[model samples]
Target: MLLELLLASVLGFIIYRFVYGDKEETLPLDDGWWGPGSRPSGREDESIRPFKVETSDEEIKDLHQRIDRIRLTPPLEDSRFHYGFNSNYLKKVLSYWRNEFDWKKQVEILNSYPHFKTKIEGLDIHFIHVKPPQLSSGRTPKPLLMVHGWPGSFFEFYKIIPLLTNPKSHGLSDEHVFEIICPSIPGYSFSEAPSKKGFNSVSTARIFYKLMQRLGFQEFYIQGGDWGALICTNIAQLVPSHVKGLHLNMALVLGNRYTLTLPLGQRVAALLGYTERDIELLFPFKEKVFYSLMRESGYMHIQSTKPDTVGCALNDSPVGLAAYILEKFSTWTNSEFRDLEDGGLERKFSLQDLLTNIMLYWTTGCIVSSQRYYKENMGQGFMNQKHDRMKVYVPTGFAAFPCEIMHMPEKWVRTKYPKLLSYSYMARGGHFAAFEEPELLARDIQKFVGLVEQQ
Candidate 1:
């Protein structure tokens, strides 16, 4: 008993030191040139140019031809989405896409927002800038940058833009009107893909910081999920002074000693600082955390290790790409959807919106580039990156969506973001918070902003 007690005390002390002993450190603010060929000797053009989304008849024809030629294997009997995207339901989706879906109309919708491209670090970064349609006298809209993640584009923010930029029209308060900037992570959509290697989240964050600076913003708020969450987190770590506040719908705070205590059971977890909600979301540990990750993370393993090989196959076949990407939307949004025939895709999203997102990847021929991001960011392994070890100092807000792929407790988030100011248990939503539940996410953002301003 004495020996066991001694070992426990030593282990506890080690964990305490590892989690709380380190002095705050900032990730090195590095620079990179992602474009093909050697870095240019001259200065990069800083002009922000207007851009529009356009589609040709040939593009439409090709898409239809590809859809018609797609030869999908029949799904196993009653498999639903458990084994993957149900081919039975995929046929229904393809019929609508080929017959009812209008690419031209979708293109126009994409162009509704003011799209712009600027050359940053030899790459043309694409983003949409939306300002408040109406603002009270002497009230300037806050500049907020909302980034998109893998298999998603800036299109994800369309629903939430109006709520943030013109709240009064949407039956919400205008106290926090925002001039929103939704940028495509380079190589995702319209943004030019990096021709060279070693372009990771930190590099993207630096380029975005420069973009914000060129836009004349001294300080701004940032928000994101998935890869966006990591990129935004890097921005905060790289330059906390320039980020007025940080907001995230998802966070990557696992892979630490704290997570190792889960097997100790709920009684001990509560003593380790996990709340009841955390316990509820995390218990049945074998099923929720362990098996869930094992089931859902097959794509991550593929993307991180051999993205290019699969990217080639996906980028070539539109049908293959849709299945690959849409499967994530279905599972990540609500894993339980896997039990449904249609994957419950339309429960919270429309075919038009979902297909529009897929079209961005298809039209831009950027699937390969987008998949490479996983390799660049995670190829080195988890918690191996310098930024992973550093805690964010800027005021941070986190919205814990109930159906998110993994539930992050406030205790876990606080370890990485020591200045966390707002932590809300969102009523309803999943991975795609803005796309799935815009009002809920917008309200959380406003609440977090209010807290930051109060501080």
Candidate 2:
């Protein structure tokens, strides 16, 4: 117990140092105990245990029953996803989920890649670690950590995993093979949730960094989008030297001067260093930034303040959980998709793939803990943390998917990632870049790392 208290004090000091320490700052290699109640005596277990995703008939039956019993409100005539996951479309997904979506098969696919769980800070941190099947002689696989965000699971990278780990077989250059590690953010799925409050992206980054070191990696690359983007960014900030390179498909460059000039018209926006594509996507700034944030951020507002309240219903009702989670997949993948009758979900993702992700949350009953992350990070205020204001010094690459809900120009991404080495306007895809455009994302990662290697 005393050790746990000491751990807490040490973590606090580390964060304080990062915020107030000198310019030559480096985040501490602190330890923690995140298990429930009081931390146990003695050094925490450091063993890595192999894991497999499993499901039972009863669990499947219960989910099917919930789908059978769902009482969906009717979408107003001609109304699409504008009002959220349209009830009409939810029916199609629910029908497939109940009748044809095979959870057992999906579980097998999930287990195809090796998984491991190790205790970090008292919580069982779950991650999938995949090494390249075959490396050229004298070649060593690069370690890449891919993090997922809200309404997303490690499953987001399942398709992209094979590509990165075996690019030679995937018809892509084998110049940079990766041993990929995709960890479920604590409380996201198989990973154990923090017993106490205040576990946010920074804590996640620290845990993941330790996870790599424990797996025998002293330095590795990091890649992410959504909350994953922020978590990877924090890893770079906390331990820039440990990160060989950082890559992101999404960025949180809020309140930067680049965004501030967005409303000044494209002429002024260009003066601020935006590209013509940026002007095309960001003009009528009200519709793109202000109105979009206002319209889409309702969930953020509630989750940041009262996550448990909303998470209660979501955890209890599988259908309600799907509606809540899938809504983001629809709008985030392409805001315009929301105008379609089916919300255009299946255009980019298979129903089995989508439901498999939802099932991770549904089976684990982690909606509440996962929702609490928002409160931990944003409950205080957006961009209010030390890392939020700090610039990352590590070499960074960004892939700007055109259909991302809010268009973040290259200039905006560069402001936060000062060491931005590569930026690409992805030909197609949206927030779920890896899921929708695995080949494209994989190529970009390879391209970015290739440049870093050249340096």
Candidate 3:
């Protein structure tokens, strides 16, 4: 049996209240201050500063010493990843990380792009701003904001940035050259973690919106997956005029009553507004959808209620953190990868690439803060929030990557986004779409922008 890469069980409400009404609800764009203690007197600083990633010998030596001492537990016979990262295979990764992995080289790769920080809500907001190296005559690059989700950082967009910014060099048409801004959500990587409570996606959207204004973009395109998807949606909601277009690879749209007919709805799917592809991807509901959802959600349950407790060990032990985080990369990339002895981790991604992501959490010690976001967002319960009850009025485009943990039908997406202009069923890829399939994602983004530009 092959396991599909599991979704962030952090997706709220196993038994969601799937209701739709004619209320025409809109999101309230509220302001916030997320610093520790009470809000400080006087205005918050609004200066932007250039930043670079650097690693020292002391950091490398400390990491090496930790890896050398990781005690291992043995896995049961041929368990593979059924029981989580097989400890047997982890030894291989440990050996590579301990003996061959190069943090300094990866740091250099990270710094290849321009990075900057600005204070938003009293927290240092980190983001990368990429401009086309050369522009055609009389052309201005389009501005875009790409937000990252949990277990992922701005690094995921590195490969795709050049493809979008300098498409002419990559054999793609130069119709949509872009100036891209990829931001680190507060409490992730280089972005300062929120010291106070209630720092959910809404605050994040406001902060990123402020970031765009600080960068002098009155309006821009927004894209994301996982938490990034929700943040982009909130950005559209909070300030629809400021968002020119919204693109996503993941959505948290809870299914309405019609979703329950999935097992036998294949034959009558069209009658109910579902596409053939939706039926093909969603049917066999028990194995592919229900059980898979249940199997993958343990982390969400723990994170939503006690993220700090679960993340304590993860923050303390790098190997443990890798096991916890990398397991998602394996199972989520392609569920079938779970059966391989090595979890088939490198099939679509290099260890260097994967470890660099892990290093972000390890170096920043933001695991607990990152996990707490789930608690802050979902601990209060799903569908009970203001944004959950609203619809995004912005023009939207969706890249439905075939292997995405769950399929978001066109009709389903339209319920949340009234003006969905483009919906493409991608030929390949999964949850971490940008990281695994840059060209495909980039092309999809370009295609969506083309459609948006025309309208």
lDDT of each: 0.89, 0.86, 0.86
Clash tally, candidates in order: 0, 3, 5
Which predicted model would earn the best lDDT? 1
Question: Model 1, range 1-455, lDDT digits (tens) per residue?
Answer: 22242345345545545775757767888778888899979888999999999999999999999999999899999999999999999998999999999999999889999999999988999999998886668889999999999989999999999999998889987778899999899999999999999899999999888889989999999999999999999999999899999999999876445676776788999898788888888887777777777788899889899999998999999999999989989988998999999999999889989999999999999999999999999898655677766778999999999888878998878878889999999888899999999999999999999888887
For residue 167, give model 2's deviation from the true position in Å: 0.6
The CA lDDT at 192 in model 2 is: 95
- Cα lDDT tens digits, model 2, 1-455, are 22232344345434544665435354555656678888888888999999989999999999888788889889898888888889987888888889988899999999999999999898999999998887758999999999999889999998999899889888999889999999999999999999888898889999999999999999999999999999998898888888999999999875455444555677887776677888888877777766776778899889999999998899999999998989888888888887899999888888888889899999999999999999999898644576766777899999999888788887777766778999998999998888899999999999999999999
Residues 57-159 of candidate 3 have per-residue lDDT tens digits of 9988988889988999999998999999999989989888998999999999999999999998889999999999877589999999998897899999989
Q: RMSD (Cα, Å) of candidate 2? A: 6.3
For residue 293, what is the lDDT in candidate 2? 69
Candidate order by TM-score, decreasing, is 1, 3, 2
State in Å the error of residue 18, model 3: 12
TM-score of 2: 0.94
Task: Report how far residue 48 has shifted in candidate 2, in Å.
Answer: 0.5
Clash-forming residue pairs, model 2 = 32-121, 33-121, 34-121
> Is 1 or 2 the stronger prediction by TM-score?
1
